[model samples]
Target: MDTNQIVRAVKTPVTLVLLAVLVYFAANWGLDAVRKPIPPRPPEPCVVQQIGPELTPDHVYVRVYNGSKTNGLAKRLGSVLSADGFKVVKRVNADRDDYPRSLVVGHSEDSPEVALVRKALTNVDFMADGRIDRTVDVIIGSEQPGAAEQPDLKVPLPDGTACLPKIQTVEVNE
Candidate 1:
């Protein structure tokens, strides 16, 4: 073949190869652009239910009344208490009467669970007054009328550990 024809033949093949590469990359990019991404699912609701209030001397039924307006702290407290082997008998939204965010230990009498409740309360900074008094049954403070205006139990916690308050019985005014 002549020099010009030979050069033209080589150029034609090179051009075809370049065109094929360009088409392959363009198709790949276009397919990727058109592909749809999957969306994420919503989170599950928190498991906060009344487990019941009946206790033995060794196993006292502890109920944490999370009457705070915000649920973040209450949820955290519930999870922490449950992890510590305390069975949360009930999880209720605070009514007006449930104010002062009380922690009830025994249904009729004081029990060892009262101490555990007290310890847990101290860790929570928003508890109105951490009381472990008898005659009150198990009543935590809520934001309600006639609720005792006591300061929150702010016990100092060690590093990487939560401080739970000590439970003590209060005198009832008859």
Candidate 2:
């Protein structure tokens, strides 16, 4: 208590107005605890299943979308349907873009993930839209559904179980 009486009791004026009201209530409670806002977790349930006998493209699960006007056409076709191993999970923007071709909505356009994403498009078209999980929605239009061939890499599954999707591994930094 002797650094000149603690700098004369912190330069008094009621201790400098209690240190400016404790630094303005700790800078508004530390900016309301750093501008509060964190609620966002609840999206893990992208279907699931796969007993397999054959159905490659990592058991298909796409979602692409980008109905034309091509601006990052559904994230470049969801990275070319995730490098053709499918399981994209979701890319978006399709409520109408004057789509002149591509499409693949599923649930049964000869399900096998909509004929393996309409055989990786080139002028695709197909739509059943029953949607019972077994995801598959391609969409991208105005012509640009190129890359994704596989000409039959595997598609047996006559019911060895296959309601895929649940492989969520996204990390696209670019």
Candidate 3:
């Protein structure tokens, strides 16, 4: 064969092989781009809810009456009881006739949890004239000292006075 014919034949085969390789790669890239991705499955729902015992052993309910004007003092007492591992509950700032100012401490009816509540008197600084006449169910009523003032147990009470021991104050913020 002549030189020009030989060169033309070799060039035709090389161009055809290169075209085939390009077509294969183009098809592969096109298929990958067209394919869709699988979506993720959702999480399973919970079936049961469990009931547990009280977290704290002690529960306290404090009632500071309107006439008492000692909300800060009652809050301080609540913080103290809570610090002592007690679950403190507040029921205060209510009408004088409906809720008397007295501390009501008792055990939970459902569980063996002890509770203490302090209710301030209408005109007195102490609770219920400092006389807790209840059956002493978890130290029913106790006179709470002034939140800012220290208690003097030996201080003589005025005539017809009620007295309760001072509970240790807890510095909640500190």
TM-score of each: 0.32, 0.37, 0.26
Query: Model 3, which residues run further than 4 Å from truth?
Result: 1-67, 97-101, 105-111, 115-174
Superior by lDDT: candidate 1 or candidate 2: 2
Residue-level lDDT tens digits of model 3 in 60-145: 22333322444555455556545544444443343433333343332222212211222221122222322222211211123333
Clashing pairs in 2: none
Q: 88-150, model 1: which lDDT tens digit per residue?
A: 555555454435544443322222334435544442222233332221123334432122234
The candidate with the higher lDDT, 2 or 3, is 2
Give the top-scoring candidate (lDDT). 2
Q: How many collisions per candidate?
A: 20, 0, 7
Error of 3 at 15 (Å): 99
Query: CA lDDT, every prediction?
Result: 0.43, 0.76, 0.36
lDDT of 1: 0.43
Where model 2 places Cα greater than 4 Å from the true spot, the runs are: 1-10, 14-18, 32-39, 42-50, 56-59, 70-115, 123-142, 146-163, 167-174
